[model samples]
Target: MEHQAIDELPSGKICPQKPPKNFVLLVSVLLLLTIVQLYHPSIFRSLFLSKTIDSNPQVPSTSSSSSSDHSNVQEDDLPSITSNLKCDIFTGEWVPNPEAPYYTNTTCWAIHEHQNCMKYGRPDAEFMKWKWKPDDCELPVFNPAQFLELVRGKSMAFVGDSVGRNQMQSLICLLSRVEYPIVVSSTEDQRFIRWKYTSYKFTLAAFWTPYLIKSKQVTYTEGPTKNGLFELYLDEFDEAWTTQIDEFDYIILSAGHWFFRSMVYYENQTISGCNYCLIDNVTDIGKQYAYRKAFRTAFKAINSLENFKGITYIRTFAPSHFENGMWNEGGNCLRTKPYRSNETRLEGLDLELYKIQIEEYRKGEREGRKKGLKYRLLDTTQAMLLRPDGHPSRYGHWPNENVTLYNDCVHWCLPGPIDTWSDFLLEMLKMEGMRSAEEKKLRITNDTTLN
Candidate 1:
């Protein structure tokens, strides 16, 4: 009947026909479904966006990954919102996530003794239930198998202080469900370590260059409190990481808390300045100057590394949440939950150090373009700054039995908020994959560029 309604012109050509009512209704339903897919795909199922992504989404060939990591999700999993919303994942607030904490202390053996808060009897478990939610979109849980596919045949090195190693450890624990890597290289002190995933040929390593430059720790004593001072050489690159990073495909640089320690600056083998080196006639130039110079040297070195052509990510400074007193004088982070967006702000040394890192990253990016190298930033500063409750605090030991530091407000607790940093990393990897070659070449930042 609908076809019989066609109109004919003078030349007997069928000019037009009205659309069927059912066809129009079907088109309207499809449009509504598309909107739902764009805004709220999870209404259908968990990890609902299982459609094949045009970007990198490769699963292992063997397919024996733990069922928990692959729970109702498909092998082609990607963060549903980050790739679609064009939003900044770093500028977000912590929200309740009942499905959080993919792995815990017993499940993952990579957690360090200090960060093993649960192992040492931490009181509250609520801190592990929160997840970062970007202002514009939702951030799904981290998929270990999906991340393994993203770097199946490549090498990733975490080059910085223990914080960088903390991130690497979190990553390993996240991937523990799929494969547990073997330590191919490790030092007696575990300062420098390497792990290999034989199935994927994926290599992970950590270099203990806190300064990212040539430096040494000097034993210094002052009254009852014993102190350690670092002699920083701003001009010379530390061959520990610089020489070995040539073979890596990815480099994650993180170090800012170490700069707060007593430091003596060197320029050409002689003392140039000091932050707290109480020796006579040595000018105390403060840590900011030394910190900037070291970062500049590190950035400049990345541009000059002979055969090192890989992506470098400078994770911004993660702040401390010491309340009422200094760390040495009974400081602690005792909150049971995360802070609201307005409850805290990024200020003081954290903000200053973050600015310096980003400033240097921009300069390094400009220089790297000439050499055809890629540089990116995993800006975790603002996000981590809110997670005061996610630290080990007094739980680092058995109630002050015999620990070096009684209060620890610097590093984060394992199986806690720091796991969200893995979420951020996976999102950034997906963002990189979604872009064309020219888009990746452009300089990206925490806020503006991503939006």
Candidate 2:
């Protein structure tokens, strides 16, 4: 066979034919583009044709241990489907966060008088310098502007006790960077306070129902008692909140500290028993019994509301760190730093109350799902249990003032560890938003298939 004629050089090196004009132009253009890309690395992200991943990242850890998507955990919570995926964002540690105390007491007037530790002369500021860091993944720092925009034109309520109010105030202060809320209404006792953001048209309210049920101590002829024994009706809803709850778009329910007070618990309008009353022939049920019932009633009221349509978040109990003595007997929390995981653990009354709240929340979640409602678990117990240093303790008031004063171990200081609760709140909100969109898409697909 005759070999094809080949172009060759005199030195024996293979010689190639001259390239076409179009091919030469293409090679020059490719060489120029490669140089530009090397210099301008971010240019590809802006171009749609580039293979940049425009998708969400998987959450670091979950109860289900599924590393693929958040939907696995959320689908587990949906009543429409049977699921085992569970997300546990609450299990975490306190890493050194230099950018904490995002707002000071001066910047946010929402700081209550009882929690104004910095203004009242807190000796150490290190407690406010750290943030909660989840062990499984990095939690995103709270974005107030993003939070406000997410709930624009909606209303949220904090219904339960003072700690719930503490988290609500943290949220308010966090959002103040975007827009400060104005007082729409308030009660004389500060039990019912409503604030509206003029710019965002968002309303935030707190309805005081320490018992989450109808309760009142028969006061003396003189006036109301500060530490009077309460009569908690376990089966009845506290109209203080239930009457106003239907209007809210979001409600955060929490109750823990108040149940620990000296009290009597009732059911079905009859005297069931007393917690610590030592009454004649009245059975002495434990505080946890009342705590459990209070949560159950709160959840029942939410599920019972026929016209109320909204998302409910149960922010589980935040344990108070009263050490050495009880609050009345000069108890205090004076640590300047967070505890290591090995150094402390969540147990005792705090853990018990947290578990009770969760049990009721899960039961209510199942019931609420039947009404096409949503319920979420905020689960701040484990995180806050490590921060005994976060409370105001004796720093809430002037130590030398000639007046009655008690160490505030139950409430948290402003611009302190409690602010992380708002961080958790915002993160949960993002998750809920994603889950809602997914639910809507699924519903639409189901409807189309039915047709």
Candidate 3:
């Protein structure tokens, strides 16, 4: 290679030479600045584009930015389903039935720990621990004052079996506070359990009919027939019930306890007019279907009134297990305190009764909506059965004894499981257009003339 001088030019070309060191340095600095701006956006934006931060404050900053996005994502990703009324095993201990030995004046031997509690139980300290009843088993005193405040000036009737009477007694006790010096009238056609209060005109009554409708109670003697099956005429009973039930404002109807009669009946009037044999509806239409039809008919009759503005509430089945069959094959509720009934152990027959009745009533509600009537069914069956503590069982059977009669029996003691039912009813009543204090005040104000 030939060597060239520091400053040399080709012929006819101006001197082409290297630039100054200062000029080279300036160009290098500019390239370095551009690279930094391109690689780090946050640094570049803060230095060059501060206007973006001022205009939109919602965007994330360097350190605190992640928290905002995390909260928004959580809200957007939440599940839609919600649980409202939770079914739970009862929280309290078992209380023995209060009226267990009403006529005996002593407790039954089964669960009663008291020697004096029952006249029949043998001498033992276990019997001494037994009072005539279970303490925790008694019905908790409900917020009756609040309830009476709600039901005051309203006409309500509890129509059912003796269980209904239990409810009526509790309700009467509650309302009696508002209306002292209570008055009761009883007769064949008209029966009234009333509390007269001058402060607010309110009447609460319970109409007793084990069968809400009428059916003949007949007795028979075995003669020409090898064995006699009782013949109950359900016609005259139903007619009488329909004629009388139309007067109530709000009807609380309950019936399952009465339906499980040991014997069934069929009407037979052929002995007089013409020789003909009549059979029970169960033999013809079937029990489940027949009951559904009858319920629908009764619903129609009740809903046919203009003044009957209140709701028709059906107190669903309250399960009782006196026979060990309902609890377990040989396991009966023999202990003192309440426990959970083994729902998994119930027999096919008992389960069938429960399933059919619930289905029938639920089906009735579906059919009722079409005809412009309202029927609200309250399912207390599972709720009551789960409480093994509430039953008298072996504890309060007789005052002094400890062994309960039948273990699977359904009738519960007063102020027991059924008292909560009244609470449930009050809640339902509020839902079905019962007026509150605020509404009543507004009404009174509106009714007054503005001068």
Best by lDDT: 1
- lDDT value for model 2: 0.74
Off by over 4 Å in 2: 1-87, 186-189, 219-227, 402-405, 437-451
How many steric clashes does model 3 contain?
Answer: 45
How well is each residue in 104-172 modelled by candidate 3, as lDDT tens digits? 212122111211223333222221111121122222223333344445576667777666666665455
lDDT per residue for candidate 1 within 1-451, as digits (tens), equals: 1223224345766666767989878877887677766644333322332321222244222221111111111111121224444566677799987766778899899999999999999978999999888886666667676567668899999999988888999999988877899999957558888899988889999999989999987776642223577789999999888888999999999888888878889999888998877867788888889889998999888889889988888888899888889887887888888888898888877778888888888788778867877777788888888888999999988875877667888888899888888877776665554332324334343236679
Q: Give the least accurate 10-residue stretch of model 1, judged by summed lDDT.
A: 66-75
TM-score of candidate 1 relative to the true fold: 0.79
Clashes counted in candidate 1 amount to 0
**lDDT, candidates in the order shown:** 0.76, 0.74, 0.43
Q: Candidate 1: lDDT of 331?
A: 79
For model 1, the superposed segments whose C-alpha errors exceed 4 Å read 1-86, 186-189, 220-227, 440-451
The reply for model 3, stretches above 4 Å from the true place, is 1-141, 174-181, 184-199, 223-240, 265-294, 304-307, 325-333, 341-347, 366-371, 393-408, 434-451
The order by descending TM-score is: 1, 2, 3
